[model samples]
Target: MTWNILVGGQDRLDAIASVIRREQPDVLALQELKGWSARRARDFAGQVGMHAHLAPSVFGQPVAVLSRRAPARTRSITWRLHHAAAVATVGGLTVVSTHLNPFDPERRRREATWLSACFFRTRQKVLIAGDLNSLDPGTDHSEAVKRIAPRYQRRHLRPDGSVDTRAIQAMAAAGFVDVGRGIGPTVPTEGLRQDEFGDFRLDYLMASPPLAKLARYVSVRRDEVTDMASDHYPVVASFG
Candidate 1:
């Protein structure tokens, strides 16, 4: 019942394909994708001998799900605040991949509400994962990640920051635990102008409390999976 999740920040299709090949996950979730990216995912899945479904969250932006087994309930949930939520049911679990709005708190809150509602209505266990665009629960910030910070704070309180923690709190209240927080930092980028690892963890793998018991492993792929994969690393969580 384990699955692999990939968020498409600025990832290369080839690298993404490599991860799928290496992990051999039952399911893969990709975010921040364009129409081309979707095609690439399908192509890569073909190469790896798997199946892929590209579900666009927004008009131009998309989220994709690749599976070894056909999905039972795979669909896209539209939202006003951010891109959209891509959901699929596998092994009796409802898996959702989302990236929230960064520019506006009101929008994020609205999106969060919509997402919570969707989670509430689902009968299957929930597993939520993606780059939520929030401050890492721990870490100091470089001016870059701080300058273009999301409007909302993260649910975990800190000394000083203009983050909107409301959305995270809302999700938690509905029973989703931040996987990045519990497992450890998932993002580990390094460079002169692009070193955000010293900062807190923003990537995540949230899940309903009940699903926590089913989790056998939770981790982020820190290795350089590819030369042009993405600026943000991929977070992977597996359940049994």
Candidate 2:
């Protein structure tokens, strides 16, 4: 499962912890973890009986991974502003937790290329999950995007009149599949009244072929608790 918890709001973290306890995912990926130190993340993981690896803060935003077993390795991949990937290996799978640049499509494309390269470099099954900040142009999220923020179209649309999907395409070209691509929107419209876009599908769980085959189900978690916890919703993917 993966979620961007709104800059790690203390109450939000508590809420996330509660959800984690209930869901008990094998691995949890987190982004936009502002104000969360390694110790704090570790403490939280301990409370939930998991092991945590948090990237060093970059302008207060860091990515984190928590799993039932300790990861064989943990590292951070830095790119443009407020964009990075927190990576770890657990149960023979490479798990990446990332948050891409929210406003720059071109930069996002570059970041995606790098991220995909990382996945291809390893032979282990890989799960690349996070807030990609880019949408698939082939999918019909137009109405949802319009309802959130009409102005969003002006910023995200390419000159050719397509939503910038290079980043997503990059991953697909590298043999990764977005398990939640058409599942549902991951962001909620309520808190987005002040933003450029309302509820949209911004978070994702993309995996290599091996991992994709292992996925049994994937969906967005939308309940009173998740809705009130953060602007974005949590995406869960189950593997057998």
C-alpha root-mean-square deviation, each candidate: 4.6, 2.1
**What's the TM for model 2?**
0.91
Per-residue lDDT over 1-240 for candidate 1, one digit per residue giving the tens place of the 0 to 100 score: 122232443335666667668877776666676544557767766887777666565543666666777778777766563666677777677777777764555566667767876785333578776656555423444443454334322333234554445666677777676655655544444321233233445666677776766777777666656324555556666776
lDDT against the true structure, each candidate: 0.59, 0.79
lDDT of 2 by residue, 159-238 (tens): 67666778888888888888886776776635433466555688989888877888889988888788778888889888
Give the local distance difference test score of model 2: 0.79
Residue 194 shift from truth in candidate 2, angstroms = 4.6
User: Where does model 2 exceed 4 Å of error?
Assistant: 57-60, 121-123, 189-194
**57, model 2: CA deviation in Å?**
4.3
Best by lDDT: 2
| Top of the candidates by TM-score | 2
Q: Candidate 2: count the clashes.
A: 1
Q: What's the distance in Å from true for residue 117, model 1?
A: 1.8
